[model samples]
Target: MTMVSDLFNSREIALGVWLMIAIIAVLFGKSTRSGFGGVLKALFVWNLMSWLAGMAVYISAFIYLFYRIGLWTPDLLKDTVFYILFSATVSMFKANKISEDKHFFLEMLKDNLKAGILLEFLIGQYTFDLWVELLIVPAAVLLAGMQAFAANDAKYAAVNKLINSIWFISGGFVIYHVVDSVIQHFHELLSLGVLRQILLVPNLTLVFIPFLYVLSLRMVYEEQFIMLSFKLRDKKLLRFSKRQAILKFNTDLRGLKRWVNRWNLSHPQTREEILVTIDAFKTQQYLEKAPPVVLPQQGWSPYVAKDWLPDEKLKPAFYDPAYEEKWSARSGNLKLDKDWSGNGITYSVTGTRLAADHLELRLAAYESKKLDELHAIFKERVALLYKNATGVEAPLKLTNAISRKKNIHFRQGIYFISLEKSIWGNITEGYDLIFTISTKND
Candidate 1:
């Protein structure tokens, strides 16, 4: 209570409190992966220098403005002192070591002068009662909350516009009252001397208040990010299902990305590494839950007999005449397609004849299974079919498919097989087995 009273009653006390706030803001306002030491350097080294430079720029602007307005006599040293203190407060609050802009201080000065002029010159004159002054704080906070919600959620745009109008109108009334008091008592207020002017407080405190509010808001978001990071690091799967964990991780990652963009921080390699680890973990979990792989039966080939012909040996149940017109329109080739069921699994078969001696066959199986498991199963099927057709062992390995990262290709004599996984929209949907047999060059 005593300190709060001193803050309003003594300019020195108020200035000291503002300085302490600035120091605290500098100490914790950065996104540092280097821990405590990095925060200390930000406060005492890089940010300190930036704040000092910004302060010098703002103070110069304030002094030049005062001189241009004919209010810069020797007796106005008190006003100059207040301006210096005010500039230091603003500079410390706005300083950023990593992403500071060269024009930031100039922009800050322009904005401050514009705000002051709008409040003092354009608003005319008015006054408010003590009760009204007390009500303004809660009213402003409520309106601010509405504005924040409206900004984030598009459904509240009309409400946001209304809130903005209310703020502008209320601001004009407050400004008129403040400017009126200053104008009507200008000479008598000047006579109160430096100490009294300092005690009464300039509009500097108003400027300082907004900075404090913004700093506090930033701190709140930083604390939220820290909490989210900790949640991501926790390894208890029992608390959250794999899907829930993934959703939460994605949401937190998006929040972190927004924070990084807003602060203009460098790309976070640590977070990327964490994301990779999480993806590997999720993949492992998915593989553990997937059904066992089943290879195709021995000597069972998607081809009809050993000859590549669409009309000669293809069963009527596995032939679609509709594909002939479709394929011929696109590539001048005759094609056939049908869904073939064997071993309780359905395979989509497509055969296209490029020439009398050349044929392309594709067999695709769709299943909701882990990507790695599906690849393993299809690789074995392709190898088996290739060896049965050519009487030679297919040179295939899991590494061959996995390391190739998308598709695998193997050729033996006139028979060539290419294996690939199916990607439906954004996800790995299934696997494909493609065989091309050409006797033209044989």
Candidate 2:
């Protein structure tokens, strides 16, 4: 068996080749078969260009850095321009669209490739760095995975037809893509009568390519996954905090209503004034389940499962790991947790839609305290990351841009809350809670 050092080192060709195949298998799953054939064809032109440029860069950069400071060769120019082009292209894609999908294409090639689905794939082939060559096998498989997983909301979901074909034909070995890439280089060097040491450089580079690519992509993938998880968790916590805050504000309405009732009782003739307060607080509001999200919730799949949490309370005795629940409750019909006196709102599957993607409420008769509580909770989330209003520099009036659609109103607490969650999406459904929070008639 190869030693562990041999496995990690890029210096060995066999190790590198084995690593490449292994990584490709992980990234593509079943798509490394015939699907790769199509990918190879599309990538053929790009690979030829990359080979021309990268070889030139390697030679030129090596020479310049070690020896000549002047006499820039055509290879230098080719490599420099290619690097600039690729960097610019990658930056443009990143800035152009916010990739909302949490799952990465892992494309190191396609956004789920058949030939080309996204324009970025076509652009990437022409513009990416030659170092990407090492990642070719893995990304090719990832492309298949991306095609498979892009639309899937679940873990390890099935891919569509075109991708299946790619998967079918992509299996067996790493030799095909490697051989395809290097055949010309090998042939050219033999014809040129290059020295033995120099001739092997390209092959050496090829060996190291997969190792480097996998390492780099793995780093990026991990960083991205961590960051994405943080944002999602932050958003959820921000919302939860909002719910807790509502309890505090609920008390305010109670005190106000009591004063109003007392005033009306003392005058007995000031009935109209008391009536106005009641009308405002007791008004019935209805929110029908947003048609788009008219489905039930399933559940969020967070990394820290419920079983992992410690049973005892947190203490200053030791640092505790951050906790996250894939779920929570609000006592409204269509709210993320509850539906009140109405049809309530529900978020769509994508969790992108706003306006209707919220639970509705009805603030009817003496429920001002509950309304205040709800509003207060909403306010907290709004203040925090929801509107992103509270932190750092103030943003424009785009507060609603990020707020979880927490649609609420009043007809008392019997409102319908529909929760097609903004992040987890209909992961919590089939439960209901109704409660009456007594408030002094204001």
Candidate 3:
């Protein structure tokens, strides 16, 4: 009981409170995922040891520098150390890109120097009250959240400008405060005025660490998003469902665009290159999966005339292979005169060999009251053939035609279909459809 009581006593309670506050700041500022569950995952599932080691290195370096500069009293040193630890903890979460690289210790040392940790430590010397130091995390979080919110939408553009102004003014203030504090603390022993002038540019440059940290987070998120997209693309392609694959690609691409748009609004320097990369990926995927130009030769024909009609009711020309062979041999434009007639309807068929492994066929129906019936039958047959060839449902639908264009255009696997209606002079004449299918390229 005594041991347990000792753990929860005054100093321990204060330490626990500071730890809780530090965790909250990390949850808001550094976590890439969302929600309380996401926090748990980030805390427990991620590389916790790496994060701790990185934070420890950064805090130790800052403390050593501050100690060398005589910036800490023995009593004040404990609080200063805690405050530095809190700041470093919030900044260090998910900093694996720098901290876990090859030359990890050297990289961490470089990061501490490059990220203005010493300047922040100097500022902390003057702002050592626990309450004042506590406010720093909340202030940083608010500013970061506001900046992110502003980036997310144009409606918050005014807010974004205001935030930029705040960052500028706050950076200037930080520089002034550090310069003045140094002058006040070491006036007798050093030419602090000359030192201040010498340090001005570097201090000004480093004061924008908050903004830089946000940008770093965005870069990390972009890398993770890209890797995930590649995995998703591979997984969806392996499933071999054209409709699902295209749908999922479009959905994910839209999300990526929105994310990039926010990032572009926040940081426009890389917008053009980023958009170019995205467009290139889109074009590459489209070209890789695009339907073949030539139609497949297997299980394909322009025999809607013969197949749809009962054999007993068919004309003799329907039974002749030479009839189709003659049309197949003729490469130029189709002629209406070379057509088959049956049951008050006329069918004109044309076949063109586009490649060794593929064929293109056109089937036209004329003087037929059963145009709708013929179209439905033909569409069903084509769809079934497509399903058998691709092992997936045909992504085909009836679309409205415009200005003599095809009413339906669909592609699945290596097959393409263009189904259209031929209209003329207030007469519902017929249907003209083209089919192209090609064997999978080796």
Candidate 4:
């Protein structure tokens, strides 16, 4: 009876719960078949940093609270001071090392530290509340692990589904415990001798609401992928351009095989149609858009290239002034024009559409070594415009530099930006930019 009582004590139960969670993370919470070795390494390193930081924060809080309440004896004060110094020393050293390296593992330490501090503070401040220490801490740790795995894109579809399943189940458990905790705390304060059963509507509503919202978003992504896959299977993809369709539908061979096999099983006559569709997609030859294998010779000129075109002949694109003229002449009131500053830089803008869509712009910089700096300035301008337009407090704006490809795609506001580096290796020849406005209806 004494052993059982000791085993179920708050601290012991908390430790046991965390141990079980760590085991689960190593065994089933893995995102990839690459194995748990890397994840475990990251988890241990981050968790140790977290533990030290949390210890420093919580120990300081404990010392402050005890001293203020006139509960601090010399032994308690000495132990607190010792822990604070030790934790601070270890934390500072680890933080400095992480700053110096700046790897993903180091980046994850901040998240782990935040979670650990919150859990440890709750546990240390409310030491008698075994539910907070044992139940809440484990749930928080598992949620953080699953979130990190998904956020980092270290994903397998099966693992993702399993993680969400666990999320739903754990959410239910958390709701139950929270209600029990609230009831117990209420009884302690009110001195209630006995309690009747309580309604769970409020607890369930508060805890499970966010889970339902996120699950809806997950379902939306799955539906999108499924619809795209079906279109590829059916050979009826009108809405997406060839390039857009390819980018959206492309997957690894194993993934593609799984998709195809399942699709074939459901629609038996789709075998021939799917093969034909895939072959058609493969024959489209998107490889021609890739950058050159070897860098062109220093003196080589695109204008003097052996086989393509005469210097006078320009490719037909949104860049051609004549093509711009024809497009602008149409009924919906669109105009495309270029602004050339005297300094070898040009900015192109397409006229606004009535529906308020994403507009694409083409920019060219010639005979300049500050191409990167120029693009950075343009991206910053675009980010500001997006912020003002949307009225979002904190918007994520990023630019991806392309070296081995001709086209890049991303969205800011309604504007879908596609940057094409047609003559990138030799910037003397200049590059092209294209922006398309995605309409509200689309």
The lowest-lDDT stretch of 10 consecutive residues in candidate 3 is 312-321
> Among these predicted structures, which one has the highest lDDT?
3
Work out the TM-score per prediction: 0.29, 0.21, 0.28, 0.26
lDDT of each: 0.44, 0.33, 0.45, 0.40
Best by TM-score: 1
- Which of the two candidates, 2 or 4, achieves a greater TM-score against the reference? 4
- Write candidate 4's Cα lDDT for 123-162 as tens digits: 3323445666676676667777876676544455567677
| Per-residue lDDT value at 215 in model 2 | 36
- Error (Å) of candidate 4 at residue 348 is 21
Candidate 4: global Cα-lDDT? Answer: 0.40
Q: Give the TM-score of candidate 4.
A: 0.26
Collision pairs in model 1: none
Writing each residue's lDDT as its tens digit, candidate 3 over 1-442 gives 4664333333334445677976686678645325666757777754565545644565456446645675433434444444445544554543434312335334444654565755654664444334544565567669999898777676889999999998899878768966787788765336543344234323322432443354344445455455444433454432332233234444343334333333322332233444454554455345324423534543233333223223221211221112322332212332223223321222223332222233333445554553445445445545554454446766625323312236555555555545544444335454456544444321
Ranking by lDDT: 3, 1, 4, 2
Q: Which order, best to worst by TM-score?
A: 1, 3, 4, 2
Query: Which residue pairs show collisions in model 4?
Result: 358-414, 358-415, 358-437, 358-438, 359-437, 360-435, 360-436, 361-435
